[model samples]
Target: MRSASAADFNATRFIARLRSRGLTWVLAIAVVLLQYPLWLGEGGWLRVREGAQKIDIQLALNQRLEVRNASLLAEINDLKQGRDAIEERARNDLGMVAPDEWFVRVVPAQSVQSGKTNE
Candidate 1:
């Protein structure tokens, strides 16, 4: 019975020591308070990294679109001012021919021959 009482006294003393400085409680509170903002906050490191990746993708897309837009604008301007540009666009896109020009489409014929057969 004395040994049990002594063990109880030791446990009570340890609890008293823990309650004195309250260091463990403070650490627990600090971790609990900081956990959400660290891992789940919008401005956290992971969110920042994701935002940066999105911005990079948008920047690349904008660059590609800008290049495409410049090409289209140049083509539009050329078509507006240059007769040769218009003619080239029409000849290529519209399959146009001048009055004296003939349109001929010649296609290569496919032949299935085995081994060393020759024509």
Candidate 2:
């Protein structure tokens, strides 16, 4: 009968739709699995980028330390080569003076009113 053929046709269409949907879901899962290693694995882009950032930070620290070392070396050389630098440092830092001389300080009136003294 005509009603039986229509029922059969409807069942056929439903099966076809289910099969297509199954294939689509399988392909989607496959794509996700393939992308996992590229995005989250040990050799991924994020790890490489993180390593590059760490290298940059280390290089910057090394450069700053080199500059500091150079300045310290220069100071050491100056101290070793002459007594002038030592004498100046002693006079400024320790307030030292010659045995025959006196140490005098002159302060401004404004500093006195502000309650500030020489460090």
Candidate 3:
């Protein structure tokens, strides 16, 4: 018959403890693997943050476009409602003349003489 010693008993107890802790070790490894994708992996937190910034930029661009559209709409309404607005733009841009209006031409004084003459 074999004799059981204290060392053998302790070794058996240690093996049992290790077996009990195996599930904890496996769970810890699983947590680390899962966190890789949530925090550091591709299509993870970093990518989500970048996407949020792009959305913010697009929203700002949309707001600017909306303001410009509103201003253009107001200008269009003014042009349609008021003949003065059309006439003002035409006179400023085209240099138009009415039938009874006289045109004035002012020449520079330097073109009047070739010599250095004081006014």
Candidate 4:
């Protein structure tokens, strides 16, 4: 009967130790589950990094557009202030020739083979 009581005491102590270890394991799992969202969830580090990359791309595009806008503004000012610039653009872009001026074009001749021209 004494040996039986000692066996019971030993079993109880083992069960108590097992319960403590189980609680620790459960707490560790809970901590990991809670932290999962902080690193990989929506609006997390990866999302913020992607947002920053998009912002950088937009800023670079905006800078390029700003430069183009400045160039267009300068061209506008030139067109408004100078007749020479307007005349140059008209002559180049519209192929406008002055009075009494003749336009000429020169094209390369195609090779002839077997008495027929290769167009």
Q: Least lDDT summed over 10 consecutive residues: which range in candidate 1?
A: 110-119
Could you give candidate 2's per-residue lDDT for residues 1-119 as a string of tens digits? 57988999999999999999999999999999998888888988888889999999999999999999999999899999999989988998899998998988999998899999866
What lDDT tens digits, residue by residue, belong to model 4 across residues 1-20?
57988999999999999999
**TM-scores of the models, in the order given:** 0.72, 0.73, 0.60, 0.76
Predicted candidate 1 versus true structure: per-residue lDDT over 6-116, tens digit per residue: 999999999999887698889899999898887779788789889999999999999999999999999999988979998898898898998999998654444333333
- In the order shown, the candidates' Cα RMSDs to the true structure are 6.1, 2.9, 7.1, 4.4
Q: What is the descending TM-score order? A: 4, 2, 1, 3
TM-score of 4: 0.76
Q: Look at candidate 3 and tell me the lDDT of residue 116.
A: 50
Please, what are the lDDT tens digits per residue for candidate 3 over residues 37-109? 9988888999999999999999999999999999999989989999998988887788787688886866667
TM-score of model number 3: 0.60
In candidate 4, stretches whose alpha carbon ends up further than 4 angstroms from where it belongs are: 106-119
Model 1's alpha-carbon lDDT is: 0.86
Q: Stretches of candidate 1 above 4 Å error?
A: 1-12, 20-22, 111-119
Off by over 4 Å in 2: 2-20
